[model samples]
Target chain A: MKYLRLVLRSFLRSKRRTVLTILSITVSVALIAILQSILATLNAFANNPDASNRIVVRHKVSITNLLPTRYADWLRQQPEVESVMGLQWFQGVYIDRSNFFPNFASEAEFVNTVFKEEIVEYSDAQFREFLRDRNGALVGKNLADKYGWKLGDVVSLKSELFPITVRLTIRCIFRSKRPADELALHFNYKLLEEGVSYMKGRVGTFFVRVHRADDVPKLIERIDRHFHDAVEPTYSETENAFQLEFLKMMGNYSAIIQMITGAVLVAILIVTANTMAMAIRERTTEISVLRAIGFRTSQILAMLMGEGILLSVLGGAGGLAIAWLLAGAVRGYVGTFLPYLQNFHIDAGTMSLCFHATLAVGTLSTFIPAYRAARRPIVDGLRSL
Target chain B: MSGEPIIRLRGLAKSYYRESLEIPVLQGIDLEIPAGGYYALMGPSGSGKTTLLNLIAGIDRPTGGELEVCGHTLNGLDDDELAAWRSTYVGFIFQNYNLVPVLTAFENVELPLLLTPMSRRARREKVEEALAHVGLTEWMEHYPRQLSGGQEQRVAVARAIVGDPELLVADEPTGALDHKNAEEIMALMEGLNRDLGKTIVMVTHDPKAAHHARHQIHLEKGVLDRTIEVNR
Candidate 1:
């Protein structure tokens, strides 16, 4: 307690320097927290994708090479396959030059049934209405609001591959807080079949939702066997494996994430080491006095290390509080850019690592300076003017 | 220097090493300081009076000496034990009244007593008594920078006696004081010595300050020569 007053006085005496150091610590930690939060949310969303129980069957040559339309009928006959649906990448742009979102050509009859987890809203009546009209469409709430398209509003879209401008009547709009299907627009696939040029009797891919999540592997093998020698050879995969392949094409997201993590740690080390060095430099006389008053060299060392731990914990708590308040909102805002991320945590494990790194900087940074202080002769220290 | 000794040193030797050469300061000297006596040691700068005082105060280890204080030979005591001995037995008074700048006079005086097991109430009472003894009862809460030179020295005297140590050692106790303030500080020490029967050993280069002592010893080249003994 006696030594604590001395330490407090010393720190208080250099308020500006201490405040600056703390500010640096807080900023670095907060930035690190935000980065980790974004990465965490993306990892969670991608790893636990809503469509993992489903499989995608795209044309073996390219997505533009549609599978024979008869493949869906054949797949539905398989005992393990419950339902099959079609999806085509629409590759379209809105009437206005600035607005951008993904548009998908999908089967109105089997789309919601095969991708049930992605259904934000719909019923049998609306599904029949959309399938009956070649011009009918359902858009995401964000896309609908972006272009002010209400139900029955004619929306014009430019198709890069088709010669004619595509027009659609909005049949419904669905908004979801979940990222997976929240930003997509579903167009009538039957309408696309007549307007767009394609190989005859073909669809973009097959989506198969299994009866049991565990039977997916056996079901995949059975489904693949049926298409092994077909004219349009198929590439079938569970939804998660498809996502993994997409992420793999991204050149090493995991390594990039690790690099970000390491950069944050190194930034923290720089600030902490700077703060500790500054703290030790200013307390030479006070440290000497404490040693002379019968506190051992080890005790003096403890005194300094204690002060640093307190400072870091202060900065650490400040940073984590900022993260806790802002992470949820930030995740929601960045939903489209990286859809997998869900939450950020300053958990015990990260905190424990922070503590150890902080402790190392606090304790070890004191050695060269505190020891310079401790090694001075008492009479020499007392004689200082 | 004494008929009945409270501190004894036999064949004392101290050396300062410059590289490999041992530059001798004190070579083969014997001295004694008696209990309940006021003595002054006078010498020029570098005459080894401060070194001898430090040796006696157990603040510095002697290279070779059979140094016994209050009948315990200090030859074999470790640093912890030596510090314990100094806290319980030897009191120090610095020339500049080395009160810690951050502490009040009362708190500064309470420092040596912290080494003891005394409870707060007893310690407070002892500190009050010590302040009253030095005639600065009103200055207890003042910082050293706030007090006059004489008052700061008196606080130093109070701090020394607060531990109830048997030996009081002062190095150049009145060196920095003006004559009138120096006299007041000397008179305070004399009162503590003569009235309370506390053994006080003061080193000074000023004869007017030494005049307050009952005995005086002159140290030249680490050898003490007994001078005039006066009974006041």
Candidate 2:
């Protein structure tokens, strides 16, 4: 305990160097925390297709292929599949063409029943009126924000695949907690079909609400088996598995993150080692003094190592704090592409490893210098002064 | 008058070899120092007075002889053991007053006491007594930098005596001091030898400093001449 006091004094003696080293480590750990947090959050959010008992039933053929307009009605008639809704991508862009949002078509009547508590209603009357009006659409709050679309605003969209111009009056605005969902523009399929007659009776996907989550896998397999030899083969999977497949296409991103973290850790170790060695070298006489005063060689070693640990922990905490705060500013820069930015948390186990690693580096760098200082023939050390 | 000789050296020899040339620092010397006796060694440079002092202090090994201090053979002890023994049985006051620069006079004195199992209160009490013995009671809390040469040397003396060791070794203890502080330190050493019965062996070339000891020995070319006893 007393030896620790002497070690701690060295850190206090040079506050500037200590703080700088701390900032270095903080940056590394913070980057590590932020990267790992976003991936984990995204992975979890995308995988969670079932809030309770939900299943997405896309085309019996390719999801790229359109489903029959009659499927939603057939799905609603089934005892297993409770209440169905169709969601088709509209592929629309804002007037400025710079802002991006999700553009899709779904039944305005059953949207609340299929995905309740997701899209906030703009007004009960306006919402009902939009579902009844053939040329009406509901814009998400984020989309409305992008184009300044008021309740009575009219929006014209240029379709990509259909190659047609579609216009509709904004009847209501929907709000969503999920930022991804908030930036969407939704309209009824009837308006989409009537506007483009060549695409009549064709729907994009069916959202099947099941009573139990356990029934999803079987329902997906059953849905697949029903159209096994269709013109376009169908692929069905759980939401997480579906997202995981796409994440796999990211090709070793997690591995890359780990590599970056490894490099950062090594860099920190080197910095700490050099600083510790320099400090020990400068205090050669002090070590000798401790030895002369009846301290054993081991005590001197402990003192040097203790000093290293303090420097590292100080550096580590400082670096971690700075990294955390820096990540906050980065949120405004990274924007919605990296959500859960505030989820950055310091993991004690990792920090403990850093602490122990620092201690090891301290011990390693000081070994030669401390031993040299301690083992000096006492008369020589005394003779020096 | 009270006990056996606290230190005995028999044919103690130390040699340095520079790649095949054996240079003997101390040759075939036999000596005994009893408790309470004050002995001073005087010699020119290369006389091995410092080397001889180092051997007696257990800081170096005898190349050919047996050295026993307070009933323990020096040859049987390791460096760590010797340090432990030195803290308990021997106190050193170097010529330049080798008090740690970072420590105050009190902390310097408190250093040797750290090795002992004494509580802080006991250590403080003994440090106070040792400093008071050297007449630096008021200067205990002052750092070495703040103290004069004489005062620093006095603090070194207090440090040496703090553990109440069996023997004291002074290696030109006042070499760096002015006449006033040097004589003041010499007087303290004399009192320590005469009154407290500390068996001090001091190495010096100054006759005035050498005059304070009851026994004066001369060493030349690693050999000790016949001793001359001085009146205390």
* lDDT tens digits by residue: candidate 2, A234-318: 5556655555655676687678877877787678778777776677666655555556546777767777666666666666666
Q: Please report, as a residue range, the 10-residue window in candidate 2 chain A with the lowest summed lDDT.
A: A335-344
- The DockQ value obtained for model 2 is 0.33
Q: Model 2: per-residue lDDT, tens digit, B11-94?
A: 989998899999988898888888888889888899889988888888777788889987899998987887787778888888
Interface RMSD of each: 3.4, 2.6
Candidate 2 A-chain TM?
A: 0.78
Residues forming the 10-long window of minimal summed lDDT in candidate 1 chain B? B223-232
For model 1, residues A305-334, the per-residue Cα lDDT tens digits are 677766666676677677667666664555
- Where does model 1 exceed 4 Å of error? A1-3, A49-195, A199-282, A325-329, A332-356, A371-377, A383-385, B1-30, B34-59, B66-232
Per-candidate local distance difference test:
0.72, 0.73
Instruction: Record all residue pairs in model 2 with backbone atoms less than 3 Å apart, i.e. clashing.
Output: A22-A315, A26-A319, A26-A320
| Separate DockQ for every predicted complex | 0.22, 0.33
